[model samples]
Target: MVVQQYRDGGGARAVRALAVAGVIAVTAGCFGGEGESGASDGSGRSVAADRPLDLLGRAADVLVEAGGAETRTSMETAAGGTRVTIRGQGAYDFRRQMGRLKVVLPEDAAGADGHRPITELLAPGALYMKNRGAGVPDDKWVRIDTTALKDGNLLTGGVTDPMAAAELLRGAADVTYAGKSELAGVTVHHYRGVADLGRAARAASPQSRGALSAAAKGFSKDAVPFDAYLDEDGRLRKVRHRFTFSSEGPEVSVVSTLLLYGFGLPVTVTLPDEDAIYTGEIRQG
Candidate 1:
């Protein structure tokens, strides 16, 4: 929410870099190959090769075919000299382009309840938010029109479409295999690379003008490094990115991690009662 205020000039650039960096992390993958044109299995079908773009392309295809998945993200950063940790778990339906995510708010900013967790349910036309824990009146849900919000506002941009992860597959360079590793019990091939943010921004869908792309454009033109992992089938399993933003202000280091699993899993999404939804202006949490 604090990031929404920074829409132009210096601050906006910072937001863009941070947002785009996250996108690159979510979209990278693992494989073994040397060329950029295509990296395929011996059978000739793409199987998430080592080349950055090739691997991501294959992983995106696998995710698309899976229909739906659950994602967990862990973020660590320092803001105004204070360290923060935010954790989120949610499910997305690729077919409907909808998702629901619940995040455990950081303790540093926790209100009376010590940790007021927030949950969001996203649909094409509207957004819903529920703050749980303490001091909530009647526990009513706040509703906001998806069209009214500024592009890349964290609340709206963060979870609009689960399938939007595919957009991260763009603008990869300096790709190479990092090695082998195990994540959550599955064997995976690891790969690392840098993102060409400008290229990625240009390739982004019109609706993708959100925080990540904008911030990415604000950073140095040099490609930012990122890492990703994939299973034997080319399904992206994990990813991580770390960088420091130091252009216009104090240097802030960001470490972001994304874990994708439970592919094709059915998830039920429950919309709040209309009577309990507030259509009026809602303040940022």
Candidate 2:
């Protein structure tokens, strides 16, 4: 962490500048067993290739066959002089482009009474959010017509889709095998590399693609540093990435971790009642 101060020309006013770097760790939770684990056969076979890019491709294949996965993501961000932390748990159906999620907010983000978790359900054409205990009607859910979005705003909302995340695994550089380790009671291979954000932006979800495209204009084309773990079945158990972005003054650093599991398992998603939905509501940052 580093901080700098600048005195305005009036001398009576002063402005402080800060730059912070942090690593946010996201924990993995099991839903149901659906597939095997590891890049190499559990018996005694060794990895044919140690390249991170190659291993990512194998992970991508396994994810495709698995259909979708359950994930828990946590992010900590600091910019200017403020810091915010967000954590969420969810399940996404890659093939169906659907998901259900619950996001936990920090105490500082609470309303007049207190903070309450927000529940969300997303699908191809629609998105619904329910803010439990937020002084709203019990059955009143907010709905957004996803197909009507002219610009992809939903993707940039800090939600990670399993398929979108898998697509961004390509074009890795500075690959290094960090050896093997135990993740969630299972032995796995650990690897680290730089993620190609340009490629990732193009492959991410529509909202993320648009957000990345705009954000990229103000930053370098350098790859973001990332770490990943693969199981015996060549499946990606966890992946983490961290990067800093700057434009004119303050710089903001973001750390994102994605966990993939419950492969080939069933994910049941039921939308809210139409009569109970408020279609005009929008989430505010």
Candidate 3:
């Protein structure tokens, strides 16, 4: 067995994340049965392609009418080419004044018991991560704080910037009408999008100008562009993306599983290592 014992330290968190990422990709692949290579017919044939969307820009407008949560798995690779996977659970609830998501690792994750993870709430523009575990504090979590992270659903958060997430996919090509398939039982049409990190870094921040100035400087030169596959309808089912760091190439495989389609308002996020919980009335403005 390739047992990587991660002792408590700076490297422990990263190692744990990387190990779990590998397992989740393998597991998600088995569950959805979708991939870059579209499904074939009995005659060894593939589905026909759809027309390009130059008129409206993208093949479809998932962000056209926003009001629900979208959930899926996520995999992020490192600059040194290390793959890290996370079972992403996310939602978009404008009504709740928030859109949020969380990634949970399966049992096999090296430090599954020690690594702290939690919600980064988009409602109040505050970070929310799960830190309350077997014996951990409730506030400790690896995070990047951002008010825009709470602005809109991550799916369309960069909608204004078509090529924003292009660099997220490394050494990968975008396929238009690559094929049609079902994810979480929902049929969606697929399209591939790409943008250079240099170009992406120049795009304006949808929320504000000052923040964009700060974020633009740190943009990586080689962020892998992502391959987003949608069903016949218009929902993002899967993204074949690997982090392409200026240092490392395509390093992670992320498969997103979207369930309970629609908004996750009053979304029920399960607490780890616990079976009991409670809540008070959701005070809203």
Candidate 4:
């Protein structure tokens, strides 16, 4: 993939303002779904030694080992801010392959989807990319001011794994099984993820330096996402989610479509109050 560098989205935005931005909210502990908060109601929860917990643990292991993109919907929700959503298609091969991602916003959406296609392939530092099919992308791919794309939180590669997702939420959220519910025709088990703003930030601290452990504990958790995962047949299927941001408006409660298991490729997105989010063929090099 050849990335033409045009500095408009600033650090990342300017590098490739080719798509609507993503703001990530990563919180603490464990893997999969959100952690329940508040004192226990005493009705009993998934005991650590129970079959459900064991099954969940096995499922979590499957997710980590499988390590392929299972489709993803990244959303941003800020207090009194506009809401923006970006769904990535194609499996995410963090260390090997370049992932193809698409960007979109709800029609007349609270926040505008900067009509751009992120033809950018993920690398280490440079956020350079190309919109291979920019001129004729799908309808949800609306264009917005380049400034709205400012923020690296939208990059899900660093800590989007299930372990990291669960760790961020479990650190402060109480863990429990919400029984079972039917969603999109799948028998789903829900985990309540109470936003532990602080814990999430701590878990997001980049790999600690050999001697910089001192600074690690003080790292900010303000950037971690508060989201939940919906599982089907013991596999992490969709994200029951919303984010914690300042300028991205409204809490969007939605179910995401995941494909290819752990690779980060999301073929479709089901928004709670809007149309489905999807992308056409992404000729990603």
Which candidate leads in TM-score? 1
TM-score of 1: 0.68
* Model 2 C-alpha lDDT per residue in residues 1-285, reported as the tens digit of each score: 011111111111111111011111111121112233435656564462445566675555566566768888765555566666667788877667677878776665442335567687767555566764323455666555433332122232344444445545654667877877888887778878887756765655564355344333423434677787877766778877665554345555556677776767677888877688643433221
For candidate 3, the TM-score is 0.50
Candidate number that wins on TM-score, 1 or 2 = 1
The CA-based lDDT of model 3 is what?
0.34
Q: Who is ahead in lDDT, 2 or 4?
A: 2
lDDT of 2 at 108: 51
TM-score of each: 0.68, 0.67, 0.50, 0.45
Alpha carbon lDDT at 277, candidate 4 = 19
The 10-residue segment of model 4 with minimum total lDDT is 207-216
Tell me the spans in candidate 4 whose CA falls farther than 4 Å from its real position.
1-20, 23-61, 74-84, 94-98, 105-114, 123-128, 132-172, 183-185, 195-227, 230-233, 245-285
**Candidates ranked by TM-score:** 1, 2, 3, 4
Better of 1 and 3 by TM-score: 1
How many collisions per candidate?
Answer: 12, 8, 27, 45
How much lDDT does each candidate structure score?
Answer: 0.54, 0.54, 0.34, 0.33
Give candidate 2's TM-score: 0.67
Lowest lDDT block of 10, candidate 1 = 23-32
- lDDT, residue 178, model 4: 56
Residue 95 of model 4: what lDDT? 26
Residue 59 CA displacement from its true place in model 4, Å: 6.7
